[model samples]
Target chain A: MRKGFRTVSGLTAALAVTAGVGVTTAFAATTTTSVDFQTHGFPTVAAQAAIPAGQGATIKAGDATVTIPTGTFSDPVEFELLEGPLSSFAANAPSGQTPVFDFAFKVVDQKTGAIVMKFQKPVMFSLTNTDVNANSMYYNIAPTGTYTLNPVKATISGDTLQHAIAGAPVGWVVTSPATSVAQTTSPITGLPFADWLFVGAALMIGGGVLIAVRRKVS
Target chain B: MRFAGRSRKQLLRSLLLVGGGALMIAGALEIGRIPLAYLRVARAEQTTVSKPLVKVQIVAPPPAKVVSYSVNALYPPAAAPGHQPVTGSLMGRLEIPKLGISAPVTQGTALSILAVSVGHLSSSVLPGEVGTTVLAAHDVTYFHHIDELAPGDTLTVRTSQGVFTYKVVSHQVISVGTNVPNTPYPSLVLETCYPLDALQLVNQRYVVRAVLVASHLTPSSAANQ
Candidate 1:
């Protein structure tokens, strides 16, 4: 009995060590800055701000928000957010996909008068509209002046579609697949094979008439 | 003789009418059945089997620093760098112990590749990497029973680089056009055609998302080399 008890204790200790290690490993992988910010949507021509390099800002306009993290810029930048039709913000939108919303997030160097296309760190861009979901994808304007599918997936939480990007000062559009109008019925009629059935009936009737006529002659 | 001929004619007309009517009825029923089958299949597409949770012991890898809420951290770049596998080349084997699934994983999702084994999207990152690894197979084949898997079920992939184990986080039946998001951490995505028993192709897919929970490097592997 004493030997059995020792074995049990040893097992317990081993299990405890394993559990502790698992917890520590998971915690380490998840360490991140737990910074949170809130903003409400409002109608504006554009939300532009001269944000300092050391501080971040969350700019919101017309159901869209751009959250620039701290240290995203090395110098004071003039950031502008515009939300409107795709034509207003982008040179061309994707042809076959239905556009959900269009937003252009741009940042400019206050000193050099140059557009800041890339950031030092990633920034969060989200569109909060009831229509957006996993089915919706993000397309950004390319250098060739056409929108292309951003390889990154947009994470969907409830009604919002969000993605993290390191490059900006470009037009982004969220679009869903155009609903396909499938041909549920045949071209001739609502009833499938209607014409074929009529043809079969006609042939059968003709066959019966011929058989009856032959029988009478015989 | 005339009366006999008249009787024969009458019999033939009756037979013709009855047979024609029966044929028309059958055709109508078939026409109606096709649409109903489509409706039934749509419902089946939405259905997912819920199974009892299975507990399995896992030895997780040593902690590696992971960034949270970033594009590079979550999604791998579209143009993956490295010596890409030739089309139809075997990448590795994927296994789900709970479901007793062990299938060869091929490099691409082309018809020829999926015909024999599971296909890994060439654009996605490799297994055990920080980004999402997407694997897909036909529902009629290797992944037929994946719907039976519950959350927390373990999935493992054995490659030359390492043995990566993932835990099931969620299952979703999404439209074919819907994009499965790249998770914030290392993840595995299994996809199959939806409505497992449908005779015709469907516009939906069954997606299983799993997060990497444990992994160990293969000894003297190419990664080590």
Candidate 2:
């Protein structure tokens, strides 16, 4: 019974140490990964989601200098935003101002402009920032990532301009005429799977060492 | 004393068995909730607070591989009595060749059943013809991105007869009320309570209004014509 208890204690101690290491390593990884800049004045919510299966996400026009908010990427990608409703209003889509394509941007990046990480694909998306119901049930299209689409200019897909004249607010309708439309990867990319694994391993080894030495002394 | 010999061995085995079972259960629960919890968390940020009428297909299970739901169709399903004929003169189903958003549009304001459902049917007050095609989705769920739209953003509404594309011109935030429900304007009116969790009607609403630009009658209509 004494031997059994000792073994349990040893294992628990080892696990505790590992947990500690895992935590530290996780923090280290989080810290080392840098953020060049994030100016999400228009509500920081992810809109337009699709599984970036084979073809990957079509880079929206305004999001030229993309960064992987959390995960890692396999390579650097380049593409234009879709031309339709979502395509034309890339950076400023999440706003309430309407009818006119009067847009302004606060462009910021790292001082060095070294955007190493990128968000290659989004498995799902929602354009609504407030309606939880809409986010869950509204017009959601599944991902068609295996597609290779050519970069089309924003003007071609001009659907928003059409909505303004006939459908806008009572006084809000645009009486004037108009038209328009418009992540990451590193070699050791932030592939979420690999990142978590690296964290787990370091924790186990380091924790094992601490528990082993402590047992000898006690 | 003779029975005592086997009794000790049995007790030891039982203890080990019980201990192992407890630990295993704890581990499984931990794994199970990780994903479920993620969806709940994502709900805070990504959730659409619209009417909960749309169908949800649970593709992923617990441990939250479930990130987002896919929109199969937008309009409400047809009823038994020969799905109500869409109100007003028919326009073609709205189709945006770019974003791939295609849905049938009817005359008047939108119905809750019409908000985020399979499709938008004609409304009673405004009718689906040309005036207000008010689309009322639950504020937080489907209409969450309505806040993201600035003026000039475009949306296409396809009627049975023709296709019309509209641009956003203005927006308004109003408290949701049964008395003065906001429906489709001369454009697309996407409105919802501001925070979505506005149980007390405390939060102000946020609205996005857009205008219609081009109305194209597709050749597909001629084939049936």
The prediction achieving the highest DockQ against the true structure is: 1
Give per-residue CA lDDT, model 1, range B1-225, as digits (tens): 999898987787666666655655555655555455335333322331121111111223212222111112112211111244666666677889997777777677776566556777766666766456788876766677788889889999866556778888778887765665443246788888777654446677777878776667554332221
* TM accuracy, model 2: 0.27
Off by over 4 Å in 2: A1-218, B1-128, B178-186, B196-204, B218-225
How would you encode candidate 2's per-residue C-alpha lDDT over B1-225 as one tens digit per residue?
656756765565555455545444444444444344335434432332221212211212211100111110111111011122444322224333434434333332233232322123233222122234454433433454566666777776543334456677777755434212222123455445565443223335565565455445435422221
Cα RMSD to native, each candidate?
A: 20.4, 29.4
lDDT of 1 by residue, A121-160 (tens): 6778877764566688876543234566665667888778
> lDDT (0-100) at residue A102 of candidate 1?
62
| Candidate 2 Cα RMSD (Å) | 29.4
Error of 2 at B118 (Å): 6.4
Model 2 agreement with the true structure over A113-187: per-residue lDDT tens digits:
322221222112112211112112111010111111111111112222111010000011111122111000000
Under CAPRI classification, how is model 1 graded? incorrect
